[model samples]
Target: MFHGLIPADRYYAYLSFRDIESMPNKENVIIIQTVGAVEQHGPHLPLMTDAAIGLYIVGKTLEQLDHDKSPTIYVLPPQYSGYSVEHTSFCGTISLSASTLTNVLMDIGDSVYRAGFRKLLFFNSHGGQPQVTEIVARDLRKRHSDLMLFSIFAWDLPNIAATLVTPHEFKYGIHAGEIETSLMLVILKEYVKMNLAEKEYPPTLVPDGGLLRIDAGLTYAWMTKDLSQSGVIGDPTEATSDKGEQILASLIASFKKLLLEIDAFNSHV
Candidate 1:
């Protein structure tokens, strides 16, 4: 509710779409379409982990943009279910097939385009949905080439990976790893029971000789059963809120810059 515009007494009040439309600078509105997942995150973290991180990054970026008087980027409610065949073995992983996800994205993109948002960013946190996102981005580009569209993963931020952790940590930073666990610590600490933290590394099925490149394009070829029995890949015992805070700060800085550049680019093209 606090967009660096209203005073503390009036900050508790909220604004509607009409209210935003009535603003003097209504032409500069940007829309952020966030895609997340309702999948499992080991026993220590909640299933909403991906959505929480997506919302957090966009919220912080919006706050900074408000402070800078940049274009107002509306944070649309996140899409909670994405394409996640890899996590299908998990008990609570609710995921859509690739075709369904792509259809939903296309419909959402069309609705937003019709609403007159010249600049749009499809912000995603779940890497499993990349194929659906790719399809949607490609189609939208072909249809509305003039509209600026960007599909991204928060972890792809410039200088973000380096700033948040060391090279060794990065190597082991997959699935419910240190980074994810730390993020859950900061975002949903009450849900995490540190005593349940455990590490898992299943044997590789791909043959060492030449299987590495075999079916490389077959996304989601390996299911959770193929990966680990416990559905965990790295150590979560060392996760802490301090590390999450550092990652959050680094991500905010990177996102603010990216949004600004997108806004500026919209003006030209």
Candidate 2:
């Protein structure tokens, strides 16, 4: 581990209730709960793709922080099964209904709130579940007016990829594409079977509407099966370890800066 203070599991799973009590600071506690899903991501990527990536992001954020300042954030064991209805027809997807997901989060919030934590930040990686997590955050606020809750789904750190990676494949590569494959290459290399990584060319524009996927302002819902047969979109063949490293580094830098501000923010509402 880069930092010696690394927890046993890089999550709350390793800590006992007494451990939280003895912590030096509790006044501005923020539980950064990562939300992900176990679902099919093409043939090359593992079912835990989103969850594993979430863990990497969180771990890197903590690794680079200035612990001497006493950051008040703790990572909870991730909610590994989220809304994955689009991929449920596939063998690997485990999904929760919108209501069930919200209530499950509410249960987590109630327990953590009762334990005296004042804030909950949902760091969601699964794209299908941000709306659900957003509802959960609002539900917590409805019950506890004093709590601070934030829900976030994606990051634009890859905007820097244009200069780093030639013929950047991120825009077309939405699902188990180059960005994710590159990330898996860096974080879980052994698991990524590159020989099996096939390119999935998504329609750059919708068939009837001719709406450009990358250049248009669009928000249409469709199942994963409706798109790629292999459960993939974008070009995984373009992925490289260097690109992944650059992306992760930028992510850590951006997230760490925001984390510092969040640790001290006092909710007005």
Candidate 3:
């Protein structure tokens, strides 16, 4: 367990060690941690697009909690490097091995559980993070049966925001597409270059591009080169800040619901 007060930052790192330590040792007190990736988001978006989007959502979630009088949730610092070996095919993408990330998450979970925090919610902003963190969460649960832990891919929350984007774009907007671009437009406008926005509908790596033309859902793996030369899928040219705001709002609301539900674990346990 950590001793003494750990400094807190509102913007960059957010929560600290002391913040979680000082909180009541109840099920309602949860540690919210997240990990993102520093990878290419097409030419229009910056290399840190994943980080910007993930951190912004985390920051907003914490800001909302400050006013709420329900559960006590602490937003720990956001980790930048996630599982992104598939993205290293493109420039500016830094990634750690799956085993490395999984072990790191397990250690963090173990420390948090030992520090008197019973519930730890992992919020991953990268597509590859969910698979990695979920495995770690399972391992933690097996080691400590009383600890309540779960990991979610935050980007998946925006699935309900599909209406905010074009029907065509939404179907193929898997990567640096309209959905991601619109979110970035609101989260970090300065880092977005609308002038460089372009559309690319890459063919699926699977045979016949899989059922219903859903390349990603195929039971196979692929790299950026197999999809697009520019390291992007879907269309970013049509992204708008207004759409970004709408999607972000929905994501925040969804996150709050999950937090409250998870905090109430004691009632059922």
Q: Pick the candidate with the highest TM-score.
A: 2
Name the candidate that leads on lDDT: 2
TM-score, model 1 to reference: 0.84
Better-scoring candidate (TM-score), 1 or 3 = 3
TM-score of each: 0.84, 0.88, 0.87
Clashing pairs in 3: none
| lDDT by residue for model 1 (92-197), tens | 9998988888888888888777666666678898867765776788898789876667888877886455456665456445778778888878777898878888
- 1 against 2, candidate with superior TM-score: 2
Which pairs of residues collide in model 1?
none
What alpha-carbon RMSD in Å does predicted model 2 have with respect to the real structure? Answer: 3.2
List ranges where model 1 is wrong by over 4 Å.
1-27, 159-169, 206-220, 267-269
Q: CA lDDT of each candidate?
A: 0.72, 0.77, 0.76
For residue 42, model 3's alpha carbon misses the true position, in angstroms, by: 0.9
